[model samples]
Target: QRATNVGYTALRASMSAAEWLTSEKSVEITVATTTLDGEGQGADCALKIHRLKQPAKAQRASLTGYQPYPVRRGRRVADEAPKPDPANPNSWELGEVVAQDGFNTDAAGKATRTYQLPPGPYRALLTTQDRFGKEVTALLPLTVLDPKGKTLPLKVPNLVAAPKWSLEPGEDFVALWGTGYDEGRAFIEIEHRGKLVQAFWTEPGATQQTVRQTVTEAMRGGFTVRTTMVRENRAYLTARQVGVPWSNKQLSVAWEHFVSKLEPGQKETWTAVVTGPDAKKAVTEMVAALYDKSLDAYLPHYWTGGFGVFRYDSSSLTSQFENVVKQLRHLHGNWFTDYRDAHMVYRSFPEEIMANLWGYQYFGGYPDGKAHGLLPGMAGPPGKDGAAGPRGDKGEVHDMEARVGGERSSMRAMEAPAATAATVAPVTPAQTPDLSQVSARKNLNETAFFFPHLVSDAEGKVKLEFTMPEALTQWKFLGFAHDRDLRAGLLTGDVVTAKDLMVQPNPPRFLREGDVLEFTVKVTNQSATAQKGTVRLT
Candidate 1:
């Protein structure tokens, strides 16, 4: 007997485990009792096992938080109308009844996948096979809505910048840099000449614009690789690629970017550390691989540094400057990413607390920063209870992370959702937790792909520069050695490269009857690609 209060997954008749436990098998049982029976005797127990009879049907799960899921059907045709012969991207062509899902045939030669439907008001039917080759048919219900409304529409996101992909001369390596190569609910797909190149997403909702894909020898010139981005839950879009030679200058070996403009007196030094030989983290491995000596870290992506909203003005700082800030902040002062800023400005606007909870430091005053022991400009962690009501601060946005060894990942990030109570067996694997792992900056690499010997200098050396409008070059204010050259070490240049980069289509952009939306792609290699040694196009 089991306690009724305990929760359990429902037992299903079709369960494979049922055949074993319910068969005439031997089962061992041991019971301990202090009570005796009839005529002054000891406790006794029986080793009894019973077969669980199969039920005629399985139980359905109760729906508690199920919301109105979006619905879609085959393009709806009015009673007086006739379905147009499929012509362009939006028109649902007479799908290959067998391969309509776009999924492939399994080993058993059967295609299967559930296709999405546009929200409401139509009816249709389809026959398809599950991956296991089991044939099945499903029905749809008809509801009334505007018959002329849009059907299932897909959109391609705008490319934030030109993608730069180049080959490591004489090596089978290619380094690509660009924006928006994330994965999950809202993900992006890289396609080359109307073909899928690769797909990536770090997490849901992070439309970041930096990714590197290792390619095989199968890659070649004359192919345009464009990023197709779409928000699975929302609608937002863009795509771009410029100057990719289809006939000549197919000779890119390395690619990178450097912001050419700097403020009056702000200085910076990039510190890079190759990942320790004994790194035990996946993030470390993946990030480190981006700078593999054989590959180039000259990525096509730029950090959205130099962008920030004014804390006091409460107004937007939406200029090229703001965009720069967003990129720089994303890199933080981390050794893992090739964060190069030639024109850094020194502003007295650090957060009062570090971005992490409990990280607080006092700076420039009677600064005995209390409560988490932080000063006025430390970052006090993000997503901190929205800093509402009493005892709150503005999301602690001003933290300083010196680039020494590794990137400091946010502790507050989206995680996999919890499973709700259910009777139906899960048809998919539960996602693994995406937790942040700490890393030291010195054990990572920032420019192995472009210049392996750039950081080959001696150790323990440091440098600092505090310039004024008059070009103040005094190191005493910051204190540092004289032999270090911060300029030669950073990844900076006026030009970058984009190989096999193309523009994806925008299908849902105000579609009317018989309209076509064109997606474009272009490729080019900047002069910077020539100075490097290794170059890979794959």
Candidate 2:
């Protein structure tokens, strides 16, 4: 059977999620003030706020079998993806705070209201606010204690803030993290030697936010950082202190011996120019890396003529690079080598070799945008006679040597050997290693293509600005368009329309004898042209 042709067109736009009112049934919030478990003086105040989880409705696509033609429309696949909303049709967000005052807490985690009034019937309002300016309000009865017997306790807001190092390898920046309830915005203050050096405000909407700063040796002894969350009239505060050390101190302890063994010429080639006696030792080892024929290593060192640039703690960055090497060894069935030997692992271009074999020239482009194909005559490990030997299971030679332009021919020659007429046992699926996880963790391999826009300005000064894609969308032009026209879209802006299809069985999991079970298929089209296709099951 053939599929039918159905074409459609639609425009797509992304808008922020709508906010829900707090008093709706879809939103549940409980605010209570309590005292510490003590008979008299030890009694403390605390506030507990609880929110109940609400179920959401999922939009599923209808599945149809043996369609006649393909459907075409103009939209991205992501736009076609189903966006299920909450089961409650009117529900959205419930974090808008109306009014809040007089919140106090003691060391024992007890909470109380700020105002002091006579012990009698009274009403108190508790409010919760979210980053989207959505708020919910609850009214409860409050009783004031008699002044003659005991004084009423005060209320205190609970805010949390801390400091941590960034994840990027060899980075000298530290990020300050903060979170709190009803925090609309946050202000951060940094101090060194009791002098204010930095102050800034964090973005709203997120309960958590981080601000980063470069730390230097001058602020080594004591660098203090603090964040204050401001929600309406209430202010909550938290602070932390850290010590800064020279960035070069992060180099691995094994670097000195590693560089000393290299030939003087090799040392000069891989070495990064470094100052300070303590740092010189670390630079030698840090600068050791595979030479990229291209000048863009993603770091300053590409221009400085060394292995790598930028100061970093060895464990933070080197550990990740080492993990990649280990993964390569496992993939190639060369796991017998000692992990302790750095040269034995890093010097071997396993990633490049794999790319060459797969004909993936653009994959994992080096910083210099040059593809350093497989090394000449380098195949597997050394055999007894010093010739290349097989490294993979079932006598498979993992290495395939190729020159710059003869990748495909070289691969064929390596795979088809004349020496062995006997067939080797096939490797079963169970014997194969999963490279998915290895590929995911190897971000270093994608450094070049990931930051394609790293360019120098008119002043000849390089600018390392990383522009992350804000939204993932696809676009198509109906008429002819040149490169300049596409670039012009950056200013004039262009709209996108796309669609995709998904199929699922009703009652997703289990099926019962009497229960109705149905198959559903959803087709999303995002093209200007009509299409004809087939959809068949089994």
Candidate 3:
């Protein structure tokens, strides 16, 4: 029984070795093309299989002394490699097999085949099963170029986006319209982080589209919008970053204070009107805001002066105000960001306040001369092509803004108005005086300075005596009559002052990066009597 078992095991081993030997068929496969062109005469591919060795004695043989093996040919494209389908295990989801040809072997056991295929890149595979049911595959890669070499690559499109309402405010709803030229289908994607926030597709021939998205504070961290144009198998991409939104509610407060200081009639009446520079349609939209009753008039220096003054009454005032806010919301994009900054400059340049007092003064009009309108360097509306200016003109829409005020003439300057409000001056530490010495007979006290009465002799010469209150550091002397305008020097030193002021920085040393420097400015009370006043730091 043991001898019989050993003989059976040897027989089983022999059978296994025979199966392995039969499966190891020595076949050499090589692929070639009849013509270099993507398209061929009859087909694009010619594959030759040379059977150098055949299976052992038990395999079937033909009388012609040739081996005919079953062979199958197919292709798998790069893009379709990831697709999966359980129904077709042998044919996993793949790009269509572009070509196939009859497989026939010659008398010398050489099989040659041909395949018809179009121009493109593909992975060609020749698969065959050995006598023992073992699979054998031969792979060949092919990249077919255009036969005529006339096909060209797709190019990136020229793209642009602009707001429908250029002056819209930060919180308002605004639509961004985009226009460009591309050959095929286009895609617009607004992305934040690695994920897509907004996406839209355009048809093959459509070059214009609009995207409406809220201008929000959260987007301040920077989100990007991208547009892609796809043609054939290629893609072109472009991206634009969203800008920070302006939030200036304080502008209303500053504007209110400015109107309050004007003369009674002037406060209610429009002093000047500005218009033109039609190239910038959005600038005209700002005219809607000028109707607010709180504002006197809109007179930008860059614009011509013949514009009609507008004032909103109780009936349309609220609507007009809302329109102004709405327009500002539309202007929340990058194009209008500089304009917002210009508004901030208007405040401080005025009294070292916050407004561009200089610009306002320039637009305010000539105090001595008649009001004359100024035209911008460029004339007429922008071109129909949505250009900011006529062809060949390097004109920027922003240049159409009012020029700096108070710069019309070298002589005109910003001047402090005469003391009309009767406000007391502040006191500085340099000239703090004794309050007990002040006389109450003249209404002079620790907090108030009193002016003394003066009498003119027969010669029209006058002599006066008054007490300078405590904290009085400096004073200006001026001569003025009831109706005549007074002209005086502007510089503090040039004007008549009671004392010489000295300004000194503490430590008397250069400031380092994080150092906080303190300043001590001193002024003497040059008057014979003590005076009450305060010092102003800038």
Candidate 4:
């Protein structure tokens, strides 16, 4: 049984080998046989054989993968990748393939695909291959948009003439004026360098706009004016550089009632007011130049200096040398007096003379025999000394002298009298009220109010009544309203709550023993008539 099993295994092995060989296009086999005689010597025979060649198997090619390039509407998209051609492996022709709904390939074995679709979400079914030549299908998401659809036209506000070149720190105001669309909102922003320093907004339906801002330290070096017009969720921006002025006293010109529109050849007179001390000075100078004959206010003239002599002339050298020597001599003389006082007046007033003049006296100075004696008539006879007056009484010392580590003595000579029973009164203790029963007043100093959503009635009016906080201050209120028709309105005002007399106190939050605190109070008088009052703090 084991021998039979071995024979079956060997047969299976031979069959497998034959099957493998037949699978190829061609196969070959060899056979050998030998016959032996009694003498142990025989002839050997060998046969060589060959199988007929089978037809070659057909090869099929498939797409590997593709790369996508950036796509835009109305623009050609060129995407290329390794080609998927088995038959034409050596082909180098590059081509672009357009698919109705599928991918394409080029002649150079590189896949080039182009997509032209409208604005929508789409999935592209791409056929590709893995490293093992296995086909792989990819699902790619695509979004397209129309290049011209839903395009909004930009409308910018036309700004007025530039503001003043320079402004005083706190006294000058920058006025910005412009014309804008009747609809939407307009914002004016002042920027120093590239940073926004201040901004102002204008309400809708205002065709003409004006805003004024005070010049501040942030606007010192220079600033730019940026205007933005917002409508339908879109903003259009425009900017202009108003150069920084080098002078603080620059003149300002303001035009009134300037005509914005006129027909061809039409004339409209506009009045411009020029202000500042510089403007007045300029006017004065102009008047003086026109009317004053002695004034040398003439236009400048240009002149060129030259030495007219031939370059090779011998005399030219001599003249040039002479000129150089003269210039050097003049320079040497100027150097001595450039920053030095060389005038005769300065020499005449020497240090000794100046000192003597500073201490000079017109009346009697020295004795008659001295080197510089007094003037003969200016001297007068010395009067005899007056008799001594009587002496005054000395002041008595009130403060006592301090002594270290000694018993202090009372300064008073007499002791205070003891209080009698009839003059003494019983002391009463302070009574504190129960905090639970005594309700505390609620603090009503509200600083802000927010009413985000307010609805109007049928009459297109909303009335709201709220108690004002107990804050004696000026309150600024800003509000806006919009209807379903897209119309809007804005409101701004200030309300002041005051009394004839007001008092504010500032006290220390906490105190420690031996600490001296300085308390202060403020008093205000807001009445029409003069008020006299006293402020006392305990």
- Models 1 onward score TM values of 0.15, 0.18, 0.19, 0.19
lDDT of 4 by residue, 1-538 (tens): 3222222111110000111111112222211111111111111211111111211221222223233346544676546444333223122222222223332222222232333433322333344332344443433322222222221111123333333545645645544443323344567777665556678776555544555556664455455666775443333456655543333333333333333322222233422233333443111000000011112236432221111221210111111111111222343433334567766643467764454344433221335311132223222222234322122123111112343212223222234343221111233334322334533234345343445565544433343333444455554544444433223334443445555666666766655554444555666666788754333332
Number of the top-ranking candidate, with lDDT as the measure: 4
Candidate 2 local accuracy as lDDT? Answer: 0.33
Q: Is candidate 2 or candidate 4 better by TM-score?
A: 4
Which regions of candidate 3 fall more than 4 Å away from where they truly are? Answer: 1-156, 164-182, 192-195, 216-222, 230-236, 244-538
On lDDT, the stronger of 2 and 4 is: 4
181-229 per-residue lDDT for model 3 (tens digits): 2333557676655567678785435444545567554444445666665
Off by over 4 Å in 1: 1-87, 99-457, 460-538
Mark the 10 consecutive residues where model 3 has the least summed lDDT.
11-20
Model 1: per-residue Cα lDDT over 1-538, one tens digit each: 6334221221100100111111123211111221112111121111111112212222111123223333435575334423321221122222222212222233323222222323222223433333344443333322211222222111112223221434422223222222222332324445444565666643444333344445433343322333333333333333322222221111111112222233323343333322111321111100111122222335444322111221111112111211111223454564566768799778654443243323332222122222343334443322334432112234323223432212223222235343322222223344322223422123222322222122222322222122222121111010111112111111223311122222222333343443333322222333454321211111
The 10-residue segment of model 1 with minimum total lDDT is 11-20
Clashing pairs in 4: 64-129, 83-109, 83-110
Ranking by lDDT: 4, 2, 3, 1
lDDT tens digits, residues 221-245, model 2? 4466677654434445566655454
List lDDT for all candidates, in order.
Answer: 0.26, 0.33, 0.31, 0.35
